[model samples]
Target: MLTRKLGNTGYEVGAVGLGCMGMSWAYQESSRDDDRSVDVIRAALDLGVGFLDTADIYGDGHNERLVGRAIAGRRSEVVLATKAGLVVDDLPTKAMHRDGSPAHIAAAVDESLRRLGTDVIDLYYLHRIDPAVPLAETWGAMAELVRAGKVRHLGMSEVSVAEAEQAHRIHPVAAIQSELSLWTRDALGGVDTAVAGPAAAGAGQAGSGDVVRWCADNGAAFVPFAPLGRGFLTGTLHSATFEGSDFRAGSPRFQRDALAANLRIVDVIRAVADRLDATPAQVAIAWVLAQGGHVIPVPGTKNTRYLRENAAAVDVVLTEADLAALADAPPATGSRY
Candidate 1:
């Protein structure tokens, strides 16, 4: 697989990385097997897909512990990244709230390090800016983590251009992770037409400006989460039926009629994939890759077969004609949430 530099950190990671959220929380919770999830992470590392992404709030710390176990001995072979600033309020309900206070930032690092079984995190992202806390205070606290050597680099997620600029002034924003799939282009300065999830409030308002371009100008990596549209873009999601605990079970985009309309977007992706002799998942990921060299997408999954399929996207380049056809595809019917 090919690789790309991790922003100004000078670290080169897999062009397409693995998002470990599903293995722990969001999708198909009943099928989650720690042994299988661990193997998937290990398999990803073996395949050069070593940029592992997770968050402390995922499964209320379960995800971090799993990742800690997975990379126990082979930590050096991976560039581990995890997030803070979001606190899980209820494990059963998956309820969460933001806490960007200095105290929260300070304590969360120690907790994350303990759960991750690491001394220093390669990339530490403030999961979301707490509306109650000043951005500078939250970012300043994160910068102190770097100065204290507890964190190597700092990043942000779902922030507007103005918010990003504010934080970048305090410290270099190494990466900005947000929803940027075929249906979600809000990060590119376009209007967010879909209904997003709980954290969608942090997503920039309409005309937030092109954050992808901002990262390019400021030397930060633009990390696109859910590059496969939470499995909708894979062309394999033929039904709206999902587990009660699954995040998509209540998402607007996953409802029956909405999903039916969204399938048209997948149809276009499938056509391009067939032309390239690649899976729809790869075509979706490759389109994200075309966004920019610094764009590293973390498509989450617990299935090793899907992991291999996503990693192969590095070699699946879309032609100009393919790009044009995709660009002309109809808008999604439901919101991303």
Candidate 2:
């Protein structure tokens, strides 16, 4: 596996890393079964997964606690990353809000460090830009973390190019994480350089207008959080596979009517899978990888079977023909929340 540096910082990680969010929360109401997920983490390490992505808001920080426990004896082998800035509840079980105040950031990192059982987080991100707070002030807090040696690099999630430049003026951003996929190509244009785009879908978002290229041009890392589009592109949610509060159930794209219409897009992936003898998941991941070396997709999964399949995506090669065919597939799906 290849490695890419975090921002302009010396910190480097495997090109394909694990996003540990699903192991704890979102996608469904769930929790890990013993060390089953930890076993998968260990396996990833053996396969050279030097990078691990987590967030303070995930399971109200339980995911960080779990990741801390999993990497307790193995900390030196990981490039650990996490985010704050979401004004989440202190109760640890409530839905949250956003707070990008400098004081909040200063307070957040210590809690993150304590939960991760680490002194310094390799990459620290502002989970979301708090419109109530000035980005410069928020970034100043992050720079303070860098100064205090509590964080090695600063990052922003779902921000814009203008905001990225402003934050970069305050401090060098290590990575920008946003939604980027075959369908969510807006980030491909430029949103990846700063934060994820299309804000009305959510907060602090923008169009995909070449953000990844800007990051590549600047030697900064571009991390795509939902690279698999919540398993839609993986051919897992074919028909009636989603049930209960499976996150996707609430997404407009996956609702019965939209999903029935979206299945046609899967046929496009299926065509490539049949010809290339590769799984749709592999094709999706490989295309993300093919976008740029600095572009890393943290595809989340609780299933060990899917974990291994996503990991193998690092080895899958997408030729120009394959890229062209997939790119030409009229992005049939709607916004993925």
Candidate 3:
């Protein structure tokens, strides 16, 4: 696997990272196997996919514990990343609410550290900016953690460029994680109305102005989550039949009609993949890699085969013409929430 800088943290991690949410959180809950998930994570490390992403809200902390178990002995080989600030209301329905209060953040870091079985977290992100709490108050608390050595670096997720600037003034914004793919390009520029959580109400709607560019200029890394469009861009999902517990079951884009309409987007990706002798998942991830050197896409999976396949995406190179065709590909049909 190729390597990329994890912001200015001086840690070089694999260009492709792993998102551990699905192993215990949203998507096919019934099929989740802890033993298999552990193996997949350890395999990811062996393949140089050391940047592991998880959240405290995922499976109500179950995901972190699982990651902890997987990387217990091989801690030094992994660049561990987890999040705080989002509370899971219902594990079954996956209802969550943002809680970025300083007190909550103060307490959450200790809990995350305990669950991850690590003394210090490499990257600690505010999962979402709580509308109820001031961003400064929450960010100030995070900075305290860094000064105290509980966290090495601080990051933000799904924040506008202005918000990034606001937090950058207080502390160095090491990284910003957002939904960026061939379909979801809001992080590049323009308003993203499809955000979920408390941000959807007002905070997230503030246009994210060329955040990728902002990160590059400001010495921060842009981390893209769901670069595969939640398996839709893999050219494998022909039907909208998902398990009841799967998050996509309720997502707008995975609806029967919308999924059928969205297949056109996959067609373009498949055409590019065929020309490059790569899989659609590879092409999708490769296009994201082309965004910038500071960009790292964490495509999540619990399966070992998919983990290896996604890791190999770092080797796939897209030509300028291929990138142009993908840039002109049809926009997605449904809300990202």
Which is superior by TM-score, 2 or 3?
Answer: 3
Task: Please give the lDDT score for candidate 3.
Answer: 0.91
Return the clash pairs for model 1, or none: 194-335, 195-335, 195-337, 196-337
Root-mean-square deviation per candidate? 1.5, 3.1, 1.7
Per-candidate TM-score against the hidden true structure:
0.97, 0.92, 0.97
> Model 1 over residues 1-337: C-alpha lDDT tens digits?
7999999998999999999999888798999999999999999999999999999999999999999999999999989899999888777777778899999999999999999999999999999888899999999999999999999999998888999999998899999988898998888988865443475433334455799999999999999999999988998888999999999997888999999998999999999999999999999999999999999999998889999999999999889999999998888887665
lDDT of 2 at 125: 90
Question: In lDDT terms, how accurate is model 1?
Answer: 0.90
lDDT of each: 0.90, 0.78, 0.91
Give residue 225's error in model 1 in angstroms: 0.4
How big is the positional error of residue 107 in model 1, measured in Å on the Cα after superposition? 0.3
- How big is the positional error of residue 69 in model 2, measured in Å on the Cα after superposition? 0.6
In model 3, residue pairs whose N, Cα or C atoms come closer than 3 Å (at least 3 residues apart or on different chains), thus clashing, are: none
lDDT of 2 by residue, 1-337 (tens): 6776666878777778899987776666555553877877777777778689999888788889988988988999999989998754533233467888988898899999999999999999989888888888889989999999999888888776777878887788778887787666767663322223332323446563567777787678999877887778888776645545465665668777778887777778778878878899888888888888788888887767887888888878787898889888766445555
